[model samples]
Target: MKRHNAGELPLSAPAGDAKRGLGKEEAAEQGKVDRYGKGRVRWSRLCFLFAVVSTACVVARHCYDAGLGRGNSAAVVRIDAVPGPPRKIIPIARGEPSEEPRHRDPPSPPGDDATSSSSGSDEPDDIDDGAGAASSSKQLPSPSKAAAHGHQQAGHPFARALAAADNKADLCGGQYIYVQELPARFNKDIVQYCDKLSPWTDMCRYTANGGFGPLLRGGKAAFQGAGAGWYDTHEHALDVVFHERIKRYECLTEDASLAAAVFVPVYAGLDVARHLWGNNVSARDELALDLANVLAQRPEWRAMGGRDHFFVAGRTTWDFRRKPGAHAGWGSTLLNLPAVNNMTALVVEASPWHLNDIAIPYSTAFHPASDEDLFFWQDRVRALHRRYLFSFAGLPRPGDAKSIEGRLVDQCKASPACSVMECSTTGPDNKCESPAAVMKLFQSSTFCLLPRGSTDTLRAAFDALLAGCIPVFFHPASAYVQYTWHLPKNHVDYSVYIPEEDVRKNASVEETLRKISPEMVTTMRDNVVGLIPSVTYGDATSRIETTVKDAFDIAVAAVIDKVTKLRRGIVEGRAEEEKLEKYSWKYPLLAQGQKAEDHHEWDPLFN
Candidate 1:
């Protein structure tokens, strides 16, 4: 087992503090502003959903009192730090004339990389100026400008809502699609609410509300790709799209729409989501399952502790099926994909055969509606998240060339915890070189090493695991995040690993390779063999259980909340006609993932 001590860093650091560490006044404002938790957490600001909800409230109040959202009338609530009336549109958001990320905390959203064609913001992506204290103080383009720029193209649906929010009647989901269980139509598009919705924006994400102050500093940070917030499967990907339908990003889609999008979650999250993180890519879809769980309180808003927002009318076969019911669809259908697909088989194929051999990590998904959560997760977590990045480190830097392929074999032979092939002496044909060739060569090897920068997520990491080979990870911080994850815990694992100093010190990997044993390697391999089949090519029913069901719950809930509070009407429900058979929580989606037996993971499903 590769127990990582540095794997969860980025998750805990970078922009994490900005959201979690709000002071008492900030906390109270957060509480009353959006207050999203299940009434339990008074402190944890519903960062993602909370912001939108708050904005919704503001938008609603403004429209009712200020005549902003009078239906079809457009109103732009420019978000900035010190709240104020809306700002005049600058025809073009030619942001404060091109600058670089400044010297503050890494709270600013990543900028469109040099490769992108940005319309105006001048801030660069490098938030810390590559220095120390500076990381604690830099800023970026005005939050208002960033938000406005982040969302352009009025032809888009969100834009339409922006246009009509001040005049036309608010749009609902029933207008979009029909759900069997629930009647009425509604959507989560901010455009639909326009004048009434204000962006309760924050600093970390690429959002722009303009209140960062000294926190907002200098340059334009480079976009590394989307952060892959919290999705675990393609089902999760669909949910993101469902919520942000009109926002130009899948984050706009509701949970129900997510139910319809069916694809492999792992690839969907890591591969597809990364593409959209900075520029036009749908960052929400890229969120990793782990991150998703953390944000599940309202998946609709990845940042706001919610599930992916899938706002569609109706419910799922929840009324029909019982225990081990289908996973909720978080609005995945909006995207161009199937809403559900069998992931159990994929889980099995992805997991290790036995439970006792290794440790499986599970996500407890915050028990919504708790007060301890307010102080602990909401408050303490905010503090810790800012101080210590306990999740996977953001990404890896170019390391000294030691040939990863060579390193893997070498490390395996030397380490006792792992089983490795001694390819040092392999003949020209035996020494697989390229990532593809190397992966093909070790398809069945007990473990394979996934180094840094494979020009996108690469094929080996997923392939090696699918082939029943455990991935000997090296960069959990960089490669693994909320945007992508599909492996079962006991079956497959990774962690906060390789302390930065260790990597920087350039300690010869040979020293670290001293760990591991043949027995451990055998154990890990056994688990891998067990998880593969369970995760991929699962039966249609299995897909519904894990992917479709989960997404549906996410989308439905978002719609329900929006309607009950905003529109005050009956919400959509899932249909009973929907068949729910063989509903055997055959595979656990939480911690331990596809790993069925060993429930000793750090996350839930294990406890």
Candidate 2:
């Protein structure tokens, strides 16, 4: 329960000569250098990364867990669940049940004006849920109180560093959440050993979600109840505290103690009432400005480089997949886009709303996970084929080799510039019979029949382009937002975009292939091969990074990289405070919902 690490740092003690002449300012400065200076920092970092792989010493085991807890500190309890005493669980009384969820932005209660240097408290008023469970002036046992009750051990260096980081960097660095201190209303899955890593939401708390006050101490309705953690706006954060907790406060209020902070990340919903308040407009006007105002803090906070506090990017947006009668809608490949920002990449599965309306409009999946890399081509080609060929022209089923062969045969006969070419006599499972045969058969033709099959990507496009043959795409097209906008659309003028619907609407595959002009095909080929990496993956080709192992590594990396860079940038004078890239509502389906609901996710990035 001690507030500071009086036991001292874990590294080799400095010689008497090292500390001989330094004063307070000098001590702090040297400490900063020891912590983050180039070589010193690198050595220490290597040691930390090594610890992840080599923590075998029993003594080191205890120390490591105590130090490297969650995303908060390098030192804390190990995240791996180790059985220990369970914190006392207090039962929360459920309020009146309503299908309308007990979700709303709660306000923080006023704190005692007096400030405690060590505690750094402008302690919020006790919970006033019609039951004065806590008196505003009630004093706590201080750090010694928990020790007396055997609730906690003395503050070790790990705990100290964790607290220090949380205090100093909560706004932009990391947050420290001692979940056991929370009432049972919170997640029961929290491990006691601290070093465990959990989802961002699990460790993060805000005024909306009964943060800081109610869960810290005192009272019946404080935590074990509904209407908690519904904080809806920035103004409401008037009471949010970082790193430390104080005596009980009002139920569902947005106010709480102020601790050291890095920045506040908001987990927001498209709530209407709070949105109105933020906009300087009244609620019934259907105001979204308030929501924007509250969210603006995220970008503004991050952009300011306020080392003490900053927002994590502008804001993040998410919505459930709307597939009817479907229970599990996992992340669909349709969400991938090249060079898109973090907020746009979501776990949205295909739904009726997107059955045919949405196209995987990404140029490339930036950091292609194995699944994405595989799905990128296969699904894309299949979708295009389904839309343009089978469905559009009512052709034979996808597996009809005879029908496919017949189409190619017809093309050879119909086009004067074409030759009877065969990748295989067998049919659709055909390889480019041989590159030599490909050159002899397709090299003279202005357009080549670029059929995309097992290798879903447009490998045919590559061959056709290289052979001076224009590719007429009936396959999956890369949906990159950047290239399509920046590059010329005629980029594919010589090529053709025979939509799957058009193909379905057509008469015969032979007739379809034969109608295209050789000159047009050649032009299309020119553009496909001339495009940028933004146009394709694999070769016209490929995507991205160290964090590729996580399920959605890009999102996590975005958050981590932004935070790390912002911190380092501030020191280097390279960036403004928060300035995290803002992602528009990237998905058309999502945008449709946003427009319908008069909602937007990238509120912070906008005005």
lDDT per prediction?
0.28, 0.30
Locate the minimum summed-lDDT window of 10 residues in model 2.
385-394
Question: Residue 364 error for model 2, in Å?
Answer: 14
The residue-by-residue lDDT of candidate 2 on 1-607, one tens digit each, is 7566857847665577667778779988998887677887789889998886675576556666677434465655336654232121111222322122221111211221111111323332232121111122223223333223221211111222122222221221122111112222112222121122222222233332322212222211211221222111221111122111112211111111111222233221212112322322222121122322332233222212122222211111112221223333321111121111212221111112221111111211121223344334233222221111111111122475423434545545564445554344333344342333343343455445544343223234433433344455553232221122222444346455444444445444445555766565444544543432222222111223221222122223233344344333433336453321232223322332344234443232222
| 494-517 per-residue lDDT for model 1 (tens digits) | 221343234445554544433556
Error of 1 at 181 (Å): 17
* Candidate 1, residue 168: how far the Cα is off, in Å: 41
**Cα-based TM-score, every candidate:** 0.26, 0.25
